[model samples]
Target: MRVVNIHERVYRAEPDALGALLGTLASRGDRLWPVGAWPKMAFDRPLQVGATGGHGPIGYRVEAYRPGRSVWFAFLRPAGFAGGHGLEIEALGEGRTLLRHRLEMTISGVARLSWPLAFRPLHDALVEDALTRAEIELDLPPTVRRWSPRVRVLRWIVSGGSARPQALAG
Candidate 1:
C-alpha cells in the first residue's frame, strides 16, 4: 500500500528564515532539530542531492533539494518503503510561513506491518516536537498538542523511557 503521512505547522517567521533551518536537519549537531524528544536528523554533509542520513530506523538520501525552500529524501532503509519524505516551506505571507514534513511511500513486505506498528506514533511525536522547537526559535508559541493516549502508549513502547512527554509550553 502507498501511504502518505504529512505533518505541518505555521511559524511566525518568513519562509527564508524557516527554510534556512534545513541546514541543521541532517547533522549530529544540528542546533535546529529538537534534542529533547526527537531523534536528531543527521547527514554526512550539507543538504543536497545524494547526501544521505536519517533520524534512526528511518533512513534516506537527498533526492531533491532547493536551498532555503524544500528538500526530499528518498528512503534507503526499512526495505519496501519505496518513495520519499521531505520538508517544504510554503510562504503564507504576512511574515508567516508554513513548514511541512511529508512522508510518501509504497509499503511492502515487512515494512507494511512495521511502519504502523513501530514507526507511526513515534514519528508523529518527533515531527511535532521538531516543529515546536522551530516555533520557539522564531519567538512564537508551540502549537497546541493533541497527544492521544494511544500515541503516548505507542511512544513508550517504541522509545522506552525516552518517550516521556514534556509540558507543551506556549
Candidate 2:
C-alpha cells in the first residue's frame, strides 16, 4: 500500500454550520462522489464501514460521522497490504472548526524499505495542495485575528502556515 495524500483546513463556522456542510455533501453524495459517494450509489445499500471494493480497485468510504462535531472519510486502493486514509473536523470555538487529514499505508519487503524515500515528498505535497483546495471549497477565511492569540496560532498551524497574518489595528 502507498500513502496517497492528506489535507486539512480551518473554518470560522460553528458546528451547526459545519454540520450543514456535511449534510449538503451527504445529500449530494452521488454528485460529490469519491469521498462521499462513488463507484455506486444505492439508497438501500448499507453504509460501508470496513474494507470494501474489490481487487486492485481504488475507493473511499465515510468512516465516521459525529453530527455537530466531526466527519471522517477513508480512501483506499487495493493491495495485499492494509492502511488508512481520512480526515477529522474538530470544533475550535463557537464559530470555528479545525480540519486534519492524514494518509497512511503499509508496505512489506523491498517496497516497504524504499517507501520512505519514494513516497514521502509526494504525499506531503499532495496533502498540502488538497488542504488548500478544501479551504477554498469550505469558504474558510484566510487566518485573521478575530479571536485570541491561542486561536490565531491554531488557525495558523492548521492553514499549513500559508495564511498571511491579519494586520492589527494600532
Candidate 3:
C-alpha cells in the first residue's frame, strides 16, 4: 500500500526569510522539530543533492535540493518505506509565504504495522509542533495552544513519557 502525509503552515514574513528558514531545516532540525519529542531531524553536512544522512534510524540521501527553497530525501531504511519525503517553501507575495512537508511512499511489510500503531500519531503531532516552532522563530504567536489528547497519549506510550515537545510560546 502507498501512504502519503502532507503538512503546511503559512507565515507572514518575507518570502526569502521563510525560504531561509526552510533551508535550515536540514542541518538545523532542532529549529524545526520539537526537543525531546521522538527523534530529532538531523543530517550530515548542509543539504545538497547526493549528500547522505537523516534523522534517527531512518537513513536517507539528499535526492534533490534548492537553496532557500526546497529539499527532498529518499528514505534508506526501516524496510518497506520505499519512497521519499521533503520540505518546501512557497512565496505568497508581499511578506507572506507557505512552508510545507510532504511524505509520499509505497509501504509494505513491517511499515504497515508500525506506521499506524506508532509512527502515524507521532508524525502528526511532530508536524504541528514544527510549524509552531516556525512561528516562534519568526517572533509570531504560536498556533498550537496545547497538545491534543491523542498526541499526548501516543507520545507517552511511544517515548515512555519523555516526549517533551519544544513548544513555541503560545
Candidate 4:
C-alpha cells in the first residue's frame, strides 16, 4: 500500500516564530509534540541530521534538518514501511505561517494490513493533537479536531482498556 498523508494548520505568526516552536519538538520544553499524551520523541543526540529516535512503536532516524524550517525522518521500523515523513514551516506571507506534517510511504507484508487498520488512524489523531498543542502554545485561537470513533477505540485497545488515554482525553 502506498500512503501519502498530510495535515497542516495555518497560524497568524511569522515563520521565525513558528520555527522556534518547531525547534522545541522533542526537547524537555517541547511546545509542539503532544508528549504527555503520546509517546515522547527522543533522540540519541540533539535535534539534527542523523539523530535517531521515534515515539512509541515507530522508529526512525532524522534524515535532514533545517533548524527553523523543517525536519525530515526516514523510517526504520515496523518491518515493511519504506519512505519518510517530515514537518515543515511554510511562510504564507503577511505574518502567516503554515505548519505541515506529511507522511509518504509504501507498506508491504504485514504493514499493508497494519497501516490501514491501526497505524493510520492513530497517526492522524496524533498529528492533529500535535497541531493543537502548537496553537495553544502560540496563543492562537485553537481549532481542535476530535478523535473519531475508530481512533478512540484504537486508543482504548492500545491503552489496555484503561481510562481514556491521555492522548484521547483532551
Model 2 spans > 4 angstroms off: 1-8, 19-81, 141-170
If both were scored by TM-score, which would come out higher, candidate 2 or candidate 3? 3
Instruction: Between candidates 2 and 4, name the one with more favorable lDDT.
Output: 4
Q: What is the TM-score of candidate 4?
A: 0.95
The parts of candidate 3 lying over 4 Å away from their true place are 28-30, 36-38
How well is each residue in 54-124 modelled by candidate 3, as lDDT tens digits?
A: 66667888999888888888999878889988888898887888989999999899899988877777677
For every model shown, what is its TM-score relative to the native structure?
A: 0.86, 0.48, 0.86, 0.95
Candidate 2, residues 1-170, lDDT tens digits: the string is 55455556667766565454444333434221223111222222333344243211334565765654454455454333356565566778867786676666666666464446433443443344444434444565433214345544543564578544533211
* Most lDDT-accurate candidate: 4
Q: How far is candidate 4 from the true structure (C-alpha RMSD, Å)?
A: 1.5
**Winner of 3 and 4 under TM-score:** 4
Candidates by lDDT, descending order: 4, 1, 3, 2
Which residue pairs overlap in candidate 3's backbone? none
Model 2 steric clash total: 1
Q: Give the deviation of candidate 2 from the true structure as CA RMSD.
A: 11.3
Residue pairs in clash, model 2? 33-37
Per-residue lDDT value at 39 in model 1:
58
Measured by TM-score, the strongest candidate is 4
lDDT of 1 at 123: 76
Residue runs of model 1 more than 4 Å from their true location after superposition = 144-146, 160-163, 167-170
